[model samples]
Target: MTDAILRMRGITKSFPAVKALQDVNLEVARGEIHAICGENGAGKSTLMKVLSGVHPYGDYSGEIEFDGEPCRFSGIRDSERRGIVIIHQELALSPYLSIAENIYLGNERRGRFGLIDWNRTNADAAALLERVGLRENPVTPAMDLGVGKQQLVEIAKALSKEVRLLILDEPTAALNDADSRHLLDLLRGLRADGITCVIISHKLNEIRSIADSTTILRDGRTIETLDMHGDGVSEDRIISGMVGRELGHRYPERVHDVGAEVFRIEDWTVHSPTQRDRVVVDGAALTLRRGEVVGLAGLMGAGRTELAMSVFGRSWGARIGGRVFKNGEEIRIRTVGDAIAHGLAYATEDRKTYGLNLIESITRNVSAAGLGKLAKAGWVNDNREYEVAERFRREMNIKAPSVLAPAGELSGGNQQKVVLSKWMFTDADVLILDEPTRGIDVGAKYEIYSIINTLAEQGRAVLVISSELPELIGICDRVYAMAAGRITGEVSRADATPERLMQYMTQTEEASP
Candidate 1:
């Protein structure tokens, strides 16, 4: 009903080898939340870049209008000057800077003679934090905060600019449910203040919750934009639009019959590596049958990652008190080396940090986890390594020019494939995948799902940990729900639902600070 605040027409962009966009059109009504939905490499980011001046004028073929006026953006500053701010998927904060300092990095409050006023900076930062629903003190250094908190800091920084148009790319990819819900509420508050927003997210549920309209992009082409208040505004339709195909199910179907119990955990507990007398995981127990994909479902920090990591190699937390069993025989997994030898491999959730060597080539990264297998007498057989890496690269359908492509150069989906390739070569009977497709796109997600289904069909006991309930239910034969570091319930795949998992994910102590 309101005049369109932002209009983009005939947006076409190209990279050297790829035609990134093709005559895309988009419009956002003033003060309404507009969502861009696409699988990875869907030109969602590229489109946002064009709008925010990240690509600037002439670099891409696009026409843009703001508030009935045509403008050319040479750079980000040009757009920022008009109250347009973009928050990238990766947060851009100085680790050493205080929250106040980071928020006011470019535009500091000035006193006489252009001197910085520390008092006004902190006070204003606190006000911005309050506006964004962050309770942390402004004086705290950025490094000390968790990722969810850092995201709030980013929002406060945007508020400091008196922003009129805000762009958030995968804002909740790294947040817990509570933080995610809080952030969505904050966005609603910002909308109430007449700020136009464009959100790029893979989470359709979140998009349905907050958006006034949704635009689906597939391979850089804009599909139909759906009205949020319309009758057909559902997940299946949005996914269909994004991928240009019917997604029968969000997860690939697995046909493996649950066999004999191959992996078991009993009376498992892990203490915090630091901070004495703090329990991270407590009294957890599970059983995994051969050829079954079992999901670990829980909210972030509900001890899902902690339990997987500790069980894999005692690699996380301290004062470990857990017993792991293989084929009903208790095994000692004192180290990562021990875990691998005993047919266990854990693909970490944080691919850039604990999962892969980002700077290395894909071939090197693939075989890094199990170099011992690809080497002879402590010397890596280069030819054998190449063969192994190339085999998995083709098998995984990793999108790169060749195996020698730098791991960092690939998109998030490709990076995840490299991580899976690393663990696949380890020859582990039990593979624990933590958030395997967290930041990937839709097309890439299909490939990952197929690979997982293949693993289960091959009789590997797979333990999958996912924050997305649909993902867990779609892929796994059985789902294990956790709350407060304890196994609360297990659901058969036939009955597994987000509503059910959320019940357990939300159950918590009635008397906690």
Candidate 2:
């Protein structure tokens, strides 16, 4: 422990009905990229909150030693003063504000008259941006940048704080392959400069690639810490430590009994909502059979989402021309309600923003899409609503104290289950699940896959959109590759491979033409 920069001894935190952490201990070296791996709700984030003062010194039982000095932080500002910064999974930056303004938001440069010093702030932000490999102007609005660039801006903001022990919570969960690599490389650069970093992520491959050492947490307890280089740790070993069992198969076994075509789209064309002249989805067609789980595989901007949204009551596109068929009969879905009435439900990719009402309770969110069912002659029965939500909560195995808990308080997996409960309550025959298992742990992913299997077994037509090819291959009976708003190729489950999917995903327009 002589060279350890951060030491967390016997940390224990509890909420109203749950013990989030128990006797958690962590030691981070001075300049190493240490990783914290665990399933969702395993108390990894809770530990970091305690360290960063989000939980405060008195709220938790822990002894924290930084640079061999015992420290008790009462608030985030107190931790920041000692160069301890934590960047959360959801970024904290105002979209309308300029990059420079956001970087110096709380700690501003004041002039002689106690006025903001704009020139120095811009110059400082520019330097920090260059260090983080973001080339955008300091005066540019944060909304103008992409998700990857915005991540860099967040890192630059931490750099402005002179952060020594930087902590990142699932930083690459939303980034693409290229951006993820860049961010990992940037972490290496930070380590080279003698800054210690602690990263929490579910992506094991990334942890294997960059992490010098890894700490595994399971059920709010520290399982073990392994030196990645010294022990030559494999992914399977890490999985066993995380899940507490040997996972023989990456995906659960499924018996496919595909039925006749139940849903089909023909000559679907969608124009960009903002740029009406630009075509987003052009002449796209696909079919989903009853008792089938189909996948839409594509790159980040391949219009898979556009195609799904455009077909679902024209919710996304401006000028949409599509012919949707249900049970071999043409249907007109001009609105979300029309789509729901026509036996269709779409679980959006962004659950926090579009899927679930964060401030609302789980019961309310689960019953949101099927409120009409609880109504009797325009009057909702409170007893029936509670019973219905309770049934779904029990069926979904949502981990919460009660069905009335706020959706925002639940972890990513529970929030996803709530979203699923909402759609399942709608009882739609055709379900479009976009990024169903994104930002969730492996255990939660298995549960979600089981749910998908149940839906398929019930003869529901399910279409999944995923950036992770392995997930698509594991769950889907057939996979359709989309590129430039068009279906490039379709492959059966027996012949799908990551390489084959990538070939179709990146197929050139000229070749298709």
Candidate 3:
């Protein structure tokens, strides 16, 4: 291993009524990829912010040393000036700008007389794009690229700064399997070029494959750091360290009888909203029984989410043709309000955008889906709303100062819980959770699983859509695999495995016309 390139000693940060980090210590060796693992709100992001100067120097107490020199960063620009760059989970590129413009956005090339140099800038951008394995034209607009290509643009932008220490926060959270593998390979190439990296991710498998060492944190405190190569570490051992306990079983035990089919969809077909003739969801059909936890597994763009959204309230696609049946009687859900009235609720995958109103307090967001239950004579009862929100907040174990806290301030896990709480408040009989545990830590995943089990035990039908096959096998009783906008196969929990599910996921793609 190389010598330590960055060291943060006795770092501490606090917010109002919350100590985000306390006595946190981190050390990263030069030319190595170090991972930071922790549950949501466990200070992983906070620590990174402190390092990248997002928290600034005076806002937190810490001793930072970079390349044997004591350094204090007053802002992100200050840190970037010293060869440090951070790419947040949300990509920071401007959609309207071209690739070359985004790469040299604030830091641009100048020709004679201090004017912009477009030719040299595009040529430099093309070279950087080639280095990052992105083949798109430098003049292509950022909005025209896919998520995977956009990620490459971010990395190219980072390289534009002559970055020495690169930090990636959940880089693969939004990528598909192929894109994820490509990104990992690119990280390896970066490491070969002698650039040290710090990656924050919930995907343990990716960490095991790419990281050299991992630092485990729990509740704002550093627990332990393990050498991935030398120690021969297993994922379970890392999970134990992050959660402070051994998880013998990935899923909680559930005891509930699956009753009659509570919800059913038949001959569902949704065409592309823009293309009109392109079919996004093709004749998909599914059923969920009361007290049953069913899973929909597929690759990204497999139409799982498209089918759910179309069925919920025709919220997606242009030409949608589907028949939904509740209690064996056909129902027409023409709008979101109609779907909610019919006891159907959808917990969206993108919680930041579609799930919660981030600017609003927890009280309002929790009661948002079920305002009619708390209204008196068309006037919302303020005290009733507060009481309901507070009850769900406590039940969901939301880590916040109070119910008045903004939904955006909480971590990813907490935000998901709030979304679940909002759906539960609606008293929906059938719940569709899309990528319910996508970006949360292992500990938070277990908590969310427990909540799903509790919902099943209460005789509510739950349908989950997830990309991780192991998660489906862990929490679901039955798994349905989708591919190319069709239901490819279904398996019982006793017969399901990652390999089996993956085969089903690709079966239709291989046979596509």
Candidate 4:
């Protein structure tokens, strides 16, 4: 404790209607990896904002000490000057800019004339990239790299500032397993170099493996901080602290009341949108029964998402050919509107980009897809829209002060709820959920699974696309694995296992459906 590099005492922050944090305390030792664990809307991000000066000094009440010195940061720049940097969940990189340019964006390398020194900048960036284990060219555009590489770029940028304390928010939320392992190794390397890291993550297993100590928060208050190296610190212990309850079951159970076949896709084929001749989904087919929950499992680039989007309305492919049937009758769905008209809905995986309008109110976003139902003649009923949105908010347990709150203001889980509410308003008979619980805490994931069960019980057919095999096994009546753009294997709940699914996912030849 005497060697603590950062100490935040009695930190209290409040917004217009919500007291986000109250009397919160945190301490991080030098050159150690610390983790913050909490559910969505549990004040984890809010506390970090106060630390990084995103909320500023006078905006909150707190006592911050850095390196045995009282610190009062007025802005992010002030905090950065003291070697503190925060990398938010959403990477803030200019896509059009080169990797070197993005790295030294604000803190640029200058020559004698006070202009940017391109040669020195690229060379320095290349060295940082090597340190972060990325082998990409410094001149390459940031947008050209995948999400995992972009994360490395953000870290390289932080390193450029000679950071002492590096804060990462859900660093591995979008990464594949291999990429996630690489990032974790990089964090360990940084720790060895005498750098302190405070990570906010929902991946408890990662925290248990890497973190030296962990602090738990719930409902805008500090719960407790546990020593990872100490005894009796289990994943369930962390979950209980974060949710304020003993979660006996990570996934809720629902009685399987599957009915007759209600939806079918036959001979579905789609070519890449940019490369016209390349097939992304090759002759994929599946069937869904009424009041049933089906899962689609695959590795990255296995065409799971592509198949869903193409089936939704040819939304992401060229040369799309498919026959979609509802209630044993063929239905034409060439556009999003056509898909909706045919009682089909597809929720995208990237909720921020393709799902909700972050700038719009929750009510507006919820009513966006089904305004036709709330409209009379040429005029839309605003009152009806509000009522319907409020109904969904209550029913879905969306945590927000009011329906008028902007979608961007809510947490990742709440934003996803808004996305589901938007589609639910359409009263679609078939719901295609793509990564419905990605980047959310265990508690929020349970709630989402419960919602899916509710949808199935209402006689709606649900198709879920996921990367997690256990989730599919836990919630689906049947799971189908895809490999190389084809259905590789199909198994009922009783026959599903991670090993069997991986065998199917790695198959070179497609298996019979």
Q: Could you list the CA RMSD of all candidates, in the order they appear?
A: 2.8, 1.5, 1.7, 1.2
Query: Per-prediction count of colliding residue pairs?
Result: 2, 0, 0, 0
The CA-based lDDT of model 2 is what? 0.92
Residue lDDT tens for model 4, 461-484: 999999888899999999999998
Clashes of 1: 2
Task: Compute the lDDT of residue 473 as modeled in candidate 1.
Answer: 81
Give the range of the ten consecutive residues with the poorest summed lDDT in model 1: 504-513
Question: What is the per-residue lDDT of model 2 for residues 26-89, given as tens digits with 9 covering 90 to 100?
Answer: 9998899999999999999999999999999989997999999999999999999999999999
Q: Could you tell me which residue pairs clash in candidate 2?
A: none
Candidate 2 residues lying further than 4 Å off, grouped into runs, are: 510-513
Clashing pairs in 3: none
Give a tens-digit lDDT track for model 1, residues 406-428.
89877789899889888889888
Model 3, position 475, has a per-residue lDDT of: 89
Better of 1 and 3 by TM-score: 3
Predicted candidate 3 versus true structure: per-residue lDDT over 1-513, tens digit per residue: 559999999999999879999999999999999999998888998999999999999999979999989989999999999999999999998999999999999999999999999999999999999999999999999999998999999999999999999999999999999999999999999999999999999999999999999999999999998999976599899999989899998888888689999999999999999999999898888899999999999988889999999888999888899789999999999999999999999999999999999999999999999999999899999999999999998899988889999999999999999999999999998999999998998888888999999999899999999998888998898998889998888899899999988888987653321
- What value of lDDT does candidate 4 attain over all alpha carbons? 0.94
TM-score ranking from best to worst?
A: 4, 3, 2, 1
- Report lDDT per candidate: 0.88, 0.92, 0.93, 0.94
Q: Which pairs, if any, clash in model 4?
A: none
TM-score for candidate 2:
0.97
